[model samples]
Target: MRRRLERHLPRALERLAHCIDQVRMWQPGQFNYLNSSQYCLYLYFLSNTIWREERGDEAVGAATRLFLLNKALNGIDLFYEIEMPEVFFIGHSVGIVLAKATYGNYLVLYQNCTVGKNHGVAPVLGDGVILYPNSAIIGRCRIGDNTTVSQGTGVINRDTPGDCMVFAGTAGALVLKPATHSLVADFFRV
Candidate 1:
């Protein structure tokens, strides 16, 4: 694991730096290796890079180890094969499950949020989407840009329009209204 990390850490750090630099809370041009969120993303990047760059069973085994380490330390279930966006934010790494899906740029995910698949069909998300705590986007769905899946709202097998705030309606329904403000800007400078 140490050797694998040493070999892959450079690419991971570069990716992590690019990601955290866009966040408003993180100081520009600074990447804290000790920060848990940063470290979690680092591990993911390393695993993903290994999975993408290396070949043979050794690469798969190394990637699996890195993935497991991140899961054990951060409590996140982001697989190495999951194609996360180049620029995204994880508010809290704990209890976050990201399945294989088409992720958009500037995505935000809070604790206990999920982006899952339904019957092997994953949902596609647009740019600048936010998934609040305890929220989920499951099955064949197309989430529009600048949309917020509000806390505790579950969007199962449904599609949402662009530039809206989503809320849970009566009996597991989704209520989407045009967004008045920029929620993604609060976290990302972009």
Candidate 2:
């Protein structure tokens, strides 16, 4: 694993650098191998780089191994194929499951947050969307930019207006309100 990661380190580090740069709490040029969050991103970057570089079985095997390693160590289900933005933040990597959805830039996900599909249709999240702990966005929904899915809230098969807003409660009885402040700004530099 170390050899493979080393072989792919340059490209992976380039991608990880783009991601870590947007985070406010992280120092410039910081990539800690011992930090689980940073390592999780590194593994994802390596897996994705390998997958994008070739279609051979060896590539697939290596990517799958890296993905599994990330899942095993970080408890995150971010696949190599998921096109995560270059400037997103993972508050807590554990128990976060992201499906094949149209994620936007500056996406923020906390522990136990889920972005999944329903009937083969995925959600389309706009820029600066934040999924708080235990929140979910499922199926054919268009989550607007700077939208905050409050803790324990679930937006299933609905659309949110593209303004600074907060979503609370389940899909059937969602409560939408203008967000008081920019939650994304707190997590990211932009």
| lDDT to native, each model | 0.91, 0.87
Q: Best candidate, lDDT-wise?
A: 1
> So what's the TM-score on candidate 2?
0.94
Superposed Cα deviation of residue 58, candidate 1 (Å) = 1.0
Estimate, for each residue in 171-190, the C-alpha lDDT of model 2 and write its tens digit.
Answer: 45888888888788898887
- Lowest lDDT block of 10, candidate 1: 1-10
Off by over 4 Å in 2: 1-4
Inter-residue clash pairs, candidate 2: none
Measured with C-alpha atoms, the lDDT of residue 80 in candidate 1 is 95
| RMSD over all Cα atoms, model 1 | 1.2
Positional deviation of 76 in candidate 1, in angstroms? 0.5
- The superposed Cα distance between candidate 2 and the true structure at residue 25, in angstroms, equals 0.6
Model 2 is weakest, by summed lDDT over 10 consecutive residues, at 163-172
